[model samples]
Target chain A: MKIALAQISPILQDVRKNINRHLKLAEKAKKERADLIVFPELSLTGYTLQDLVPEAAINPNKDDSFDAFRLISKEISIVLGFVEEKGKGSFYNSAAFISGGEVLHIHRKVFLPTYGMFDEAKFFSQGKDISAFQTPFGKTGLLICYDFLNYGANYVLFSQGADIIIALSAAPGRGINENDAFASSHMWELMGETVSRFSTAFVIYCNRVGFEDGKSFAGGSFIYSPEGTAICRASYIDEDFLIEELDLSLLRKARQKLMYKRDNKPEVILKNLYRAVFKNED
Target chain B: MKINTVFVERILTKFIKDELGKFHFKKAVLGLSGGLDSSVTAFLCAKAIGAENVLAIIMPYGESIKKDISDAKKVVKQLGINSKTIHINPMVDAYYSKYPIQNRVIKGNKMARERMSILYDFSSREKAMVIGTSNKTELLLGYGTIHGDMASGINPIGDLYKTQVRQLGKHLGIPEEILKKSPSAGFWPGQTDEKEIGIDYENIDNILYQIVDLRKQKKEVAAMGFSQKTIDRLVEMIKNSEFKRKLPLIPKISERTVGHDFLLPYDWGK
Candidate 1:
């Protein structure tokens, strides 16, 4: 499948401007004949949503914000992140899969990081489940920034029979590792390689680029093959679209070589988790 | 200034250690001015990287106070870090002797730049990143010489205000004498920062916190008990020194301009 990674810089709390940016980028991606286009976490709304969460919140079922995306989905499948307003005073950090001008599935972020500069838990409710849904491409699982950081989250998705996992991240670019200016970006790349290698599934990571609240986001979006090889990488700290050809056949070949999914014993992990939560009781 | 100094110390130390580690740097270098800012930075760097890895250079000029240099030596001895003393008198004398300038302020600026030149030279020689000592107030007020004491590969104390710096000094166990002494660049004898700026750090920090951190307007800041004249002067200083805070301007002749369109952040990791 031909995939497109749109590394965009969303204007903070400005939905209309962001919508226009998505449309322009989607048009650019379409010209390259991309079958799928993916954007970063909080691509619709910039990531620094504190009190502005309510103001910038979008109800996908009712809001017109996804209309442009829906129209774009008619030509190419697109995945993006936004603030999902579930009900009155209830919100979630979510990503939706849109294909053929319809909402395929909505994956709310499970791990809301509250450490350091991140304060997602203070604002959004945590998702309770990790599940892969049917998509035009394959059984695709979606994850937000912190969710992708957790090894267990990816394992759960793979165990649920996901062939493709897409990570939407709003990660800030940080640290200069001598050669590379963005050290955290390199860290994420290493994580991507590890996850893809272990699961033997196609992993697509899309991160944003732009400065928000003096913190810069790393836009080094990447795609990894099932063999743990980085197939393509987008630009860092810039709004650019990277179009690459994805070979899904590599998944079957890799899994056949190392069947980790088949050998994974969930019952053992489940017992350990139970013991951890209820030590004396168990 | 009123921030929790212990917490600042922990976080800033972690930040310094993490940034240096990321860059594959095991050492750091900075000019030890024996003032509150440099002292606080030195303490933090020592904690973060290591006392053995931190290099404190004491660059005294012709008119530098003896007490200040001794204070710097005390810090070096206290921390047990690598220390070097390079008298900047000869270098400053060389340039001005060929083309003499009249203004003392201009001469002071040159002295400050000479100090930076020496620091950078030592940094390259030692493979240590130059750590900046200018605090947020000094930075915002354009109080320090541009590309002089302000230049650093990375600054651990630039975010701190002068008042916060003193508090940090206490937390890091800096000498009481250094902390209590009047803040000076030591460009000339009896030179003090407040005397040159004509405003105290307490009021300067209060107004700066409001303007930069709180995002208050000049009118709003003036309403908060500061005189309009002080507000205007501080604002003007910030405006005038804006160029110092940024990279040298690159002309946009091509579609992909160096500074404008093509800005490389050195973030390309292997």
Candidate 2:
């Protein structure tokens, strides 16, 4: 499978302009023969929308703005993020998987970051589920930014027979160490490598680049092989489109070698979850 | 943490442009102090908003350093940004002449406030915001005069430390003389920041990196080879100056207290 990571800058609070840019980029990716093209979190509207989120959000079932994406997905799958307006006063940071002119899945971002520079909880409702679904490319899992910080999102999807993990992130590049490199990017790389190595599934990270409300989103989007190797990556703070061919055969070999997920311990995990969140009940 | 000058330059420049654009601002106004912090800020504003849109005002008291004025002029000339020389001697001296203040601290505060007023005056005339030049060290140490140098519509260099300011200065190709000179507010004759603060910027930055940035305890900071006295003083300085870094305190007596329980940030639209 050939996957293209479209790391582009979105115009803040301008959904129409952003969707136009996405259409142009997706067309370019389709011309390159990419099976699936992915975009960063909130690709249809820049991050830090604040009160403008409702104006920029789209209702997937009713909004006509997504028509172009659905039409193009007949030839190529597109995984992209947008502010989902389920109804008035209800908004979610969401990502959708589209293929064969139909919407396959919509993953609302479960981890609504409320600390530091994030204020998602003030404007967005949190997602409650983490599951793998059938995709044109086989079982795949989708997650919005901040969901990759913990173990549950990838682990649950991998346990459900996921072959690919797609994440959309709009994280800002921060904390330049002695090397003048972003520590946040380093953390993302560690997350991608660890998740791919453990779950034995292809990990795709698509992060946005450019400034929004004085914040600069670092666009170091990349793909990690099932063996935990970085196949290709984009530069930080620059818009880029990266396409790389993936070998499904490697996933089988990776799973066989690691067998981390095959050692299924669902009951053990449930017990731990209960112990962590339901201590008073116990 | 260190950063590449070019990379940071691009990001900061873009940030300024985007932020200013969001506020419908087309110009930036900042006081040119001829010091490292101000020079870096002026350079960024010129680069971000354009030299044409940046207005650098040189506010000098009667006793202000001649080299400082020369350095400030040199920066404006090099960047080719619009500039004005505002002699604040009359305004500051008028108040002091009546008050008959003898203390250097009082005089310094007056000078800082005088310069800040001049910057705001030009900001009003030019339709630009008063961009601040205080770096992280000065802010953390409370070395800056409250409501004086700390006032700004937007500050690009507030997060940068004195050491980082020099690093960025060197990166922006700032003149060596300006970059290496001992930092001084030029409020009084023969005044230097280190001499007044009783600590050099390097040690202050290191201790701050540990205690504030690294979130280390006082014990951990002392273990990192900082003297307990220095650590205690620095920590106290940071703690005391916390008010300068945030909005004024609004004691919560009612059901909803502004700037606290009922807080709605600037982006929390109506």
Candidate 3:
């Protein structure tokens, strides 16, 4: 399966322009015979929306703002991010998997980071669901930026038999590391490798590029094979479109060799979690 | 705290290009003070948008050192960027002459503001944005004049420390004399930043890195061998000048006050 990573710089708060950008990129990806194209978190409205979040959000089920994406999905599967307005005042940082002109699955970001340099909790509500959905490639799961950092988020998806984990991020480029990589990008790469290796699933990370209020998004998008090896990666601090072929057979080979999934013990983890949560009762 | 100069260069150049691009600006203007900070900024700006697109305005007061002026000229020549030397002495001296302020701080502030006004004038004249040169050490220590040398459309090097700026200067091949020169605001004939701050940049930057970036407590910072008195003094400076770093305080009168509830990112709607 060929996956396209669109490391694009979305115009801030301009959903119309971003929609057009998505269509153009999706067309290019389709021309290259890609099975799926993935975009970064908040790819539709750009990161750092702040006060503009409510204005840029759209009800994907009812609004016509997503029509362009739906029409484009008829040619190629697309996984793009946006602000999803579920009701009147509730908004979520969300990603939608659209294929065959239908919204297949929508994942609201589970982690709304509110700490230093992040203010997502102020404008967005946390998503409560974590599940894998069927796709043409295989069982697929979605994780937004901060969600990827949570081990439980990835574990749940993998435990539900997800073969591919598509992680979208608009992470800011921060701290120059000893290896000449953004410290944040290095952390993401480490996490991607760890998750891919343990879960034995393909980890496709798509991070955005460009600046918003002097905060530059690190754009080191990559695909980690089930063996914890990075097969393909986009450039750092710049917009790039990466197209790479994923040998689905590797997933089987990795799982067969590792047998982590076969010998998994989620029940043990669940018991520990229950014990930790209800220690007083115990 | 060693920085990857190559990576730093790449990101800073991209920052200048992208930040200016957002405002539909292809050109940049900055006051060239012949210091490490301004020289490095000029180099990065020239590399971002072609050298021809960057303009270095050297605004020298009467008390400004001649060697500093020569070093500023050297940078312009080396980078092959546009240059304009505007003497701020007349305007600043004229203002002080009318009021007759004997304090050097007040006089120095006027010169800084005068240079700022001139940079803005050239900004409009060249249809360029005024790029800032204040480094992280100065900004964090609040060692700069508010709304004077600190004002700009965008700051590419504000996050980099003074020591890191020197490291970047070395990478950019800045003139040895300028790079090795004592840090100064050029407010007076023999004034130096170290003399005014009572701490060398090496010590200041290290202390700041521990306290600010690493979030080390005063006791912890003292454990790292920084004097408690120095740490306390730096902390006091940071606290006192906190107002300079922020937009003017607006009391919350309305439900959605400007700086309180109605928070917006700087690049909103752009």
Candidate 4:
């Protein structure tokens, strides 16, 4: 399956303009025969929406604002990010998978970073669920930016027999690493490698570019094979569209070689977690 | 503390271009003081939009160093940007003549504010945004006059320290004289930043990196071999100037006060 990573710079607080940009990129991805196109976190509403969250948010279930995306999803699948208004004054940083002219799955970001330059927790409510959903190619798990940092989120998805993990981010470019790469980008690559290798799943990481109030988003989007090697990647600090084909046979080969999923002990781990949570004695 | 100068140059230039584009501005105006910070800012602005789009205003007082003026002129010539020299001596002298103030600090502040006023006037005249040149070292230690040299429509190098600014200047291929010169505020004939601040930029930047960037405590910083006295002084300066870094405080009377609770990003609705 060919997946297109749309590393776009969303216009802040301008949902209509961002939707138009998304439509244009999706059309280009369709022409290249891509089965699915993935956009970065908050690709529809832009990151750094502090008090403007309510104005930019849309109720994905009933909002007409998503009509354009739903229409385009008939030809190809799309995974885009936006602010989801669930109830009165309750908003979530959400990603929705739209395919066959219907919303397939919605994953709200669980970890909302509140320290340093981030203020997501101030404007967004916490997400409560973590699960892998069915896609045409395989079982796929979706994670927003900070959710990927928590190993438990990826573990839950892999335990559910996910074959692909898609991590979306609007990660800011910060701190120059020794190798001249953004320190945040290097850390993301490391997570992608480790997650894909142990889970024997294809990891597709898509990040945005451009600046919002002087915060520059790092845009080194990439795809790691189940063998834990980057197959394709995009450039940093610039908007780019990357398309790469994923061979399903490699997932099988990787799983057979590593036997991580076959020898997995989720039940045993759960018992330990339950005891630890309740402070129960052995 | 070392930065990748090449990457810093690329990102800063993009920042200048995009920030200007947000407000539909294609031009920028900045006071070129012939120092490393402003020269680096001018270079970034020139590369971001174009040399023709940047305007460098050289405003000097009667006591301003001649070599600094020549260095500013050289930079303008090298970059091929438009420049206009305005002497603030008359305006500053007129104020002092009426008020009869003998304090150099007050007089120096007047000069800085006079230059700022001209830059804003030219900002409207040339239809350009006023770019700021204050580096992180000065801003953290409150070494600049509030609303004088500390005002701008946008600041690209505000987060970069003085040493990092020099590193960036070298990568931008700035003239050797500007890069090698001792940094000065041009407040007096021989006023240098270190002489007034009582600490060199390298040491200041390192201590700031520990306290501000790394969140090290004062005791922790002292343990790292930085002088406790200097650390105490720097910490006190930062504490005393906290108001300068933020908007004016508002008493919380209403349900949603402007500065207290009605928080919004600066680029909102754009």
CA displacement after TM-score superposition, residue B260 of candidate 2 (Å): 4.9
The candidate, 2 or 3, that scores higher on DockQ is: 3
Model 2 vs. true fold: TM: 0.89
- Cα-based lDDT for every prediction: 0.83, 0.85, 0.91, 0.91
The TM-score of chain B in candidate 2 is 0.94
DockQ of each: 0.03, 0.31, 0.79, 0.65
- Each prediction's number of clashing residue pairs: 4, 0, 0, 0
Two-chain DockQ for model 3: 0.79
| Cα deviation of A198, candidate 4, in Å | 1.3
Residue pairs with backbone atoms closer than 3 Å in model 1 (clashes) = A180-B268, A181-B266, A181-B267, A182-B267
TM-score of chain A of 3: 0.97
Candidate 4 regions exceeding 4 Å error are A280-282
Report the lDDT of model 3 for residue B42.
100
Candidate 3 lDDT by residue in tens digits, B161-207: 99899999999999999999998877788898889878898999999
- Please state the CAPRI-style docking class of candidate 1: incorrect
Residues A1-282 of candidate 3 have per-residue lDDT tens digits of 898999999989999999999999999999999989999999999989888889999899899988888888988999999999997889999999999899999999999999998989988999999889999999999999999999999999989999999999999988775557798898999999999999999999999988888888989999999989999889998889999999999999999898889988899988988888889535
Model 3, stretches more than 4 Å misplaced? A280-282
Considering TM-score, which of the candidate structures 2 and 3 is the better prediction for this target? 3
Which candidate do you rate higher for lDDT, 1 or 3?
A: 3
Candidate 3 global lDDT: 0.91
